[model samples]
Target: MTRKASGAPGQDGHDDLQRNLTNRHIQLIAIGGAIGTGLFMGSGKTISLAGPSIVFVYMAIGIMLFFVMRAMGELLLSNLQYRSFIDFSADLLGPWAGFFTGWTYWFCWIVTGIADVIAITGYAQFWFPDIPQWLPAIACVLVLLGLNLLTVKLFGETEFWFAMIKIVAIVTLIGVGLCMVFSGFVSPAGRQASLANLWNDGGMFPNGLMGFFAGFQIAVFAFVGIELVGTTAAEAKDPERTLPRAINSIPVRIIVFYVLALVAIMAVTPWRDVVPGKSPFVELFVLAGLPAAAGVINFVVLTSAASSANSGVFSTSRMLYGLSLKGDAPKSFGTLSSRSVPSRGLMFSCICLLAGAFLMWMIPDLMEAFTLVTTVSAILFMFVWSLILLSYIAYRRQRAALHQASRFKMPGGVPMCVACLAFFAGILVLLTLKDDTRQALIVTPLWFVLLGVAYQFVRRRAVAGVVAIQ
Candidate 1:
């Protein structure tokens, strides 16, 4: 089950700094990455905007993404040679593929980090209505820095607890929602609500084909950090066993947390009553006669936001570390500290996060900044997912003879990967509508332009260094 490392770790002056992240930490961190605070808060808007059709949107995207993960899983399980998806891209495509994959991924995490910080301020406003939003945002940034700076296991354990809060909250919600659906819980309106509400409003596809498609556009955002589980492969205790087990559960988790949860919600409350500005989750427990529901949800959601931002830091830092090792990033970032953590890379990302927070704070128009940041992140994540699939296709093409001899193989093979790309391209086209999602479309391309510029700089340095040596 032990596969060899693809390349020896680059001597970053602190080889001992690598952390021993335990299985528990990785498990919870994977779960934490999957649970976005946006789902807790933003789902109401999606429901309101798309109605019952949102359920289908979640399911469709889930199926497509599950295939994407399966491809990654089979590839990673096949050989321990690849570190991150970037390494796989390099091995499958070329060294330049690694450069683009690594940087795009780094940007993906950075943008996600910005969004998480925005979500923190937005979530904080629920409790501290009077406090200037930036204060809590600043404090949370500092808190994230201090927490991550200690050690990887601590970060993992910390994310484990954060993810747990969100997980428990979600399970409780699904349970309560089911009770209301079957047992007839009396709502705030003094009337009984039940399963009939789901279809009675207009059936599951009330939004029509377009509505269903629109739902996918918004729903895809909930699945943004899902790739984080694969990124942890390099640090896994026994990746061959743990990676497959962890990944195999994604479809179930996605269905339970997203699809079923959405079904239960619209079933109880109807799609129209769901609002975009507030959480239907909080409203649900309140409707179910729990006065302290707001308090309980607040605590859960606070952790959800923190968990996302925390994972953002972890993922981005690790990506940079991986990039540094591949000769794509500044050598300083490759330095792992004494705690076995990538101290320099970790600090670099945290500093960038704080800078991101300041930009949003200074803007004053929080909504615009939040939208631009998140949409860009979603687009970048899609790019990364696309690359992973492309890498798989390349892996199969190059290693056909070898793979034929291996046991772990990607199901549906080339066709599945091609379909995933088509699905992503459709999402890209959907991004052009100048409403809630248009900013993402605009900014996402700009990000690539920036990456292209940086790619040139790195390529030149790499060429010059080789020439001088010769």
Candidate 2:
């Protein structure tokens, strides 16, 4: 799997991206990536689906994905020349691996970005009911685009603060929740807050095996951007130090944010009473007698959605720039602004995000549109994670000397990669059993088929142009 150091023309010793992302920026970016709108808005649905068992679901996904990130970290640090998993995939597997992984990751972010835009519109409606939904969606895209086009440092700063807000909100919620539980706080519905709520009604697996399985599809979607730190490898100031610290904190983030937050919500409200399609965080605050809960949660959720969309634009643009440099995308996408930003690629991704706003205008039922797109996004993200694992397997085999000599090697190596892959396959099977997820699962393959067709055309043009140059 080893390739020439050049890998390909225009790809060797030619990174235009600035390493302005300091240790703080990288850590926060990774933290921001882990905490998205999913926990704020999607947890209710998961709670409704799997009850208290959802805690275990979040933990399982987090643990498995940590291994995926470990593999990604090892690959990125193996050669300072590699930027992200996309680069190493191309170097270790072939150019096709880079093309497919890069484009698929871009698509994944696009889908997520669109969903976030639609969510922004909905959140705005809470404050300005008469305002048209598409306006806010469009406005959100424009603002993020403007900021991203300026400099990579600004993007990092924006995420740092956005992630800070989310962290503060969750910590506050947990603290308030613990008080409610200890004080025996009683809600308007007459239920008393207690840890016993976890098992009182029907136990953890309240809905049984099928119900537990139902949680996986949505739960997988909740952790969509967990691997986003990989994309910042090109711009991170200290990839070896910061990257490992960020990746190592996954377990703590999972426990603090997802597990404890959900535990708090259920402890106050009970699994059976948790409403579907509504944010449990808001509900907990309200149940705890916070008059400003609605306004506060609305503001927090709005920021969470915006943060996700901002991340999408940053990651997808970088991916396009990477692809272009490899000759897998248009040459123009490789151009950089004076600030070392991929301005053209950023604009291109923002233009695609406009399609999301268009969908909000066209689809009367915004939630339905969000559901379909998010499911597809989840499926596409799974493919990207699988590629990282597969690439790790290849890296271990083909670059055994590097693997043995490296200080930041993946803990479990080949066997761990295989286990994570199997776990992901199990989630796919779970998706098939649910009607909503099944539809997306069926639609997901078409994306790969399209990528395959596009790859052939690109490869053909490369070969023909080379022959002509000769």
Candidate 3:
């Protein structure tokens, strides 16, 4: 997919999107984006699947994804005119690459948004048990849509606070867990609090090869939004400075948020006892003789889900807007509101998201449907990520001078891209081992098939128009 060195279309380093995102906003957005509901809620399921080895799962995924982020950061900073990887894909790979990458990324977020809305409804049930689940789901979507429609800065501020709550909660949890470990606190189950809990029961890989492999299925979903910072390049006031700083801190964030937080939870309560569906964080707090903290943790998890959903709306609309600018989607989507927001695209995505939420409501088997939706989302996200890596490969091969000129060049370069791609492939293979994910893996191809068909029609129409003009 490499191309000759050529300037990208609309390569002026300016756009309709307002560059109001300062370094602080970008930094927090990166942090907020990386920390998702998956950590707060989904980790319970992952812990159950992989036992104590879930720590390794988070670390491995973080390392591989950090490389992916490095590749993305290099590509984005290579040319300031490139809004995101989607733009670079178009320029470096081809229009079809851009179309597929943009739309697949959009679809990924929409599916994720559906999951978040459902999670939000479940969380709302804690306070209002009598209320229908659908009510909170609808209210959440509507409210987030309204807020996002106002301004991009508002989205940043919202995520900033949402991420702060999560950070505070984790810090508190870690502090409490440390105290318990040092003071020799014991859980009600008589499980002594100790760091050895990570491997004492049956070693780190207690679940053996199969269980560790199975953990990847759920753990990969936890990292869906890790690349979200790249999307903000267009709106970032100083992408070169802000994007690098945000990306460079990924290892540290992963250590604190994912690794340390999970370690704390498992140490306080044995991984074998961690409920699959229930939140471990909430349980740990309750075990520590602070039942009220369960509600507070619930609120944090609720906000975390909302933040991810809010991000879904923001990212999906922007992706659609970028696609439209490339003549890959309806022109209406490219139109920006007076506030420079992609209102039309945002509304369209919200409508589709509402439809998804409605379908989830109508379905009798919620868990079954959710499993399929999430698996599909994860697969599509992998495709989008692969495209970014592929685009980076093309950028490096075709634009040699550009690579040499880059200050934030990807560390491992092509070998790292190949490794990440291999890792993603390994995840797909692991998906085939489970019945739940296997079904989604089987059905996931239909999406790419549809995209291929759409591309052919788009290409035919494009050729016909070009001939008609001639």
Candidate 4:
């Protein structure tokens, strides 16, 4: 199939972003986004906090985000010229919506990148206990930066393999875990593996309602990048075909990768026995008397962290590229390199990622640092998702013809959009119930305040430029 250029020509006569990502790239990118570093590293903490009820936490978030992706898919397909949700948001809502959504989305990934960096450092400690945590963190940032600087297609290929690793590890975990349950495998801790382990200890809601609420604090982080395919609309080959295929598979991915994997881990290890600081995936393999397999699981999870960071780097640069085109960001960000990648934005994001190493240096406790950053990332992501829903609502109102015409119309339309918004608000209220999350929540508004100020300045400068030109 012949592909058309998705971006306009720049001063140097190079296309903005090439349509080099095929259906396979989009499919794997969706999978990579569905399974995140939080699932591999933070799920242990979630299980420890919410016990078996953490399953429900993940299911609820996944279902809501599936709807968000549906809304995004429909909007992106409504107009092929729309580079991403940011473009539609600007058109359907206003310029401010685009500016806020664009920059906020960029910040979301930067913060998420930091969390992934911290996760990579923690996962590295699992293999090399004596190594400095900051070393691995900085090394990962540099490696991903180089790969991303080469080409957008290379970024897609890199994510394809990274995501494949996560898929194999999760499938292996679920399969091995089920075998142990069926064979009545006994662990070194004298616990027999069984499906009943889910509730046999203290029932599914072992820690009660508050425990269930606490689960959202980190479980939301696991779904941070679920809407990432929305960001690839500009570069995805035959987006109308690939985007829907990718979005439609989300439910299955969540059921298998998240719900089933967690079920398997809990069945083997039991909720109470799972260590909050260590990955339950590695722990499950160790309990199965395969220390070698446990080491392999550790490596898989380290790669998972790298995958999430890689997505963060890719999306943030693209978002900056979008923002700069609209004059919401500096013009330098809008320029593409000779390779057709956003090298300037890539470098900026990588420098921000190095702060992860600095964070590790400042906060010696890995989990503590991870929780704080992931919480902040989650909150900012919620804002971006909310804007997507809001844009959908506006689209439905103003462009009813577009809605009726869309082959990929959002299921349930505006009602579902409002419901999802309510669900997000509930999660925010839940965030206030804990000290760690509440601390992050309290500081989140400061981001919006800063954005408000910056928007005014940008608007004035844009008006002045037009006046000067006239």
Candidate 5:
């Protein structure tokens, strides 16, 4: 996501997000963005696709995006003027660039929000067998609406606690699983849990080169929201310090949180038996002989869903508010309540998510909802990531002089940019091979097409109005 400088002057000297989001909020919000339903529920699919090599797929994507964040950080810190990626897109690539970046990122959250709704119902089923799924789905939407409509700090606070729950769960699982791996704890099923399990099931990429590449298809989606740090620059206090800390440590984050987590999961439960269609975490707890495993995990997954949807609401509203200020969206979206929050934008995004939940219930099977939500979320991520590439290209062309002064410049420069873009393009190709992802791949471009048409209208009006004044 390319961002323009947010410090640009407006008639009122202050745009919508004037107050600084607290330190606790920024840190937890960062965690909130990093963890998602993808880790809890979706990891099984990647394992199934590439066996133990799923770890490699995640690491590869995480590494590439670490570079992207470096590039974004350099630009953002250079001026601290940009509010978000779309803001940078405008400054570097021009107005239309911001329009597309803003809206595309907006779609990213919407798709994610729908997926959260899908997950909530699934979790609810584990607790209430007789309850109709849609009942909880509707309830989740209302909860998200009220949570988001409060204050930005409240949003951050909510995310902080939600993320705290997820982090604690992962850390506990990792610590406990490590003990079992070292203690030689044998499973009740007569299987010994060991680190050797990493390669025991055919040595990493058991399915060969083809399986490794296929893992990329779902793996890319797993890291979709990792760059959300860049988007929060608008509200972050001491962003120069906070942003760099978050982006620089991504490599460590991947190893500790994702790679290690997966390694432990597979070690406890062999790859062959790990249910591809269900959460391997939940299954492992059950394997560990915990009768309450299902209930404990059900709670974890529910909070994970709330965390993701909460983030979606926060981001989508900001994107709209940013778009409106740039004159691409309806003016009302730019309006803030007395609380300095973009209340209209908040309400609008949540309402759209509510509508999406209703549409999801119309589907026959719950699993299909997961595929559909993930596919569209992946596509939205593709667009947002593509914009970051284009923004880098634009930054190089427009501000060559700043390369040296750039506080956090991207290393390897254009070469690295080209390579990362190519990596993303390859993943896009992989999406086509899976029929489920392919539908989203085909339909996603239509969103950009529609945005392009709307942009033309807005651009023409701005041009004509300026001409008349002259």
Candidate 6:
């Protein structure tokens, strides 16, 4: 297999995106991707729904996705020409696979970006109650857009700091919560913090089997951007060394960031007492009698949302740039600015992000709108992940020699890929068990239908151009 050029030349003589993202940038970006806004904001609801069982729900999802990432790592390293999963899906499958996978992944980030924008407005309200929600929503979009427009390295630097803030906050929460639990710290509610709180109430399965299943709906959103490292392959300084290091660390990050963090929160505050509408991270601080720290946690959560929105902006633009190179999107999106940033695609994504602000104004109940968009984002992301697995399956069958030669081969091989696909199918069924997610699930197919129609038009135009040239 021949490697394709990483980038095309622009009129300004910039050949491609400079390989400026160092090992540290890729590592932190992977960490940031693993830890998402959903964990901080949505964990409270998950606890209320699944009780202590929610811990298992997170672990289950994390384990399955680790395999998915392993498969992606193997595929990516098999041929460095493959910039992201989008390219591999196209190469292993048909052109239609690339079209659907690329566009859907682009839409996945856009929808998730909108959710982050909505989350940002709500977080801003924590500091400025009287400010219009749209003010912060639109403000976040512009700020991230400006940073992204500067350079890809700037995007990496911004995410590095943003992810660092999240890391510090989670570690502090876990540390503080453990201290409270060990000391038998008593809360204002006259309840003592203890590890026994995990099952002292209604036991681990407090909400029963159905409630455990419901946890997947929102919990899946927490893992939305876990595969974001794949998008940085082109900009990464050392693809062979950096990509695997980033992918291999995912399981450890999930355990520390999601599993242990949630355990600490539940142990400190008990699943029964956890409020569905509030953030457990902030609530745990207040419960520990540190009002000032709670305020600080709110600021951290706000930055987490901003970081996710920034990532969405960067990945969506790159996806569009890739799609345009394949002639699946407009040619202008294939061009880069003087700084080698995909400015056109970046602006287009920002404009779509503004729709979140518009939704805030249009819908009187913001959480309701947030729930709708988040479910849609989760569904679309599952499609992208599924495509990655499918591509791996194709690679194993068609490129057996590549698989045998891979230094970073996926574990369990093709069988694990099939199992991951089955697991995602189960999640889709779980989505329908709830009213809100069910609606989003039903509406998701329409997106693919639209993509199917658009793909035909793109193909026809390409064919006509070839004939005219001949």
lDDT of 5 at 446: 88
RMSD of 1: 3.6
Candidate 5 segments exceeding 4 Å error: 1-14, 468-470
Candidate 1: segments with Cα more than 4 A from true spot: 1-19, 130-132
Q: 1-470 in candidate 1: lDDT tens per residue?
A: 11212236446422233426667776777677667866887798778767877776777787888788888887776676566787788888888788888889888888788878877777788888899867887788788878877777788788889988888888888898888878877666655677777777777767777766666566677888888888777767667667766677777888888878887777788787877887899888888788899988888887887888888888887788778877788887777665666767778887888788787778878777777777778888899999999988998889888578656566789999999999999998887754757766865677678878888888899999999999
Cα TM-score of candidate 2: 0.97
lDDT (0 to 1) per candidate = 0.78, 0.90, 0.88, 0.89, 0.81, 0.89
- What would the TM-scores of all predictions be? 0.93, 0.97, 0.96, 0.95, 0.94, 0.96
Tens-place lDDT digits, model 2, residues 1-470: 11112223344343668788999999988988888788888899999999999999999999999999999999999988787888999988899999999999999999999899888888999999999767898789999999999989999999999999999999999999999999999998899999999999899999998888888888888888989899999888888899999999988999999999999999999999988978899889888778999999999999999999999999999999889888899887888777888888999999999976685568887677778889999889999999999999999889999998899988988999999999999999998887777888898999999999999999999999999999
- Please, what are the lDDT tens digits per residue for candidate 4 over residues 359-466? 566876766766777899999999999999999999999999988999998999899999999999999999998888999999899999999999999999999999
Range of the 10 consecutive residues with the lowest summed lDDT in candidate 5: 1-10
Candidate 5, residues 1-470: lDDT per residue as tens digits? 11332435555443447546766677667666666678887799888879999898888888888888788887777666677888888888888889989988998888888888878887898889899877888788788777777777777788889988988888878987898899898887777889999998799989998888888877776776777777778777678678877777778877877898999998988887787888888887877778998899899999988888888888888898888888788888877666667778888888888788788777888577678678788878877877887788788888888877777778888789889999888888888887888888888888889998989999998899899999
How far out, in Å, is residue 296 in model 5? 1.1
Clash count for candidate 3 is: 0
> Each model's number of backbone clashes?
5, 0, 0, 0, 12, 0
- What's the ranking of the predictions by lDDT, best on top? 2, 6, 4, 3, 5, 1
Across 221-313, the per-residue lDDT of candidate 3 in tens digits comes to 888888899888998878889999999999999999899999999998889999998889989888889959778988999998998998899
Evaluated against the true structure, the overall lDDT of model 5 is: 0.81
Model 6 C-alpha lDDT per residue in residues 65-156, reported as the tens digit of each score: 99999999999889876778888999999899999999999999998888788878877888899998778888899999999999899999
Ranked candidates, highest TM-score first = 2, 3, 6, 4, 5, 1
Error of 1 at 444 (Å): 1.6
Q: Which ten residues in a row have the lowest lDDT in candidate 6?
A: 1-10
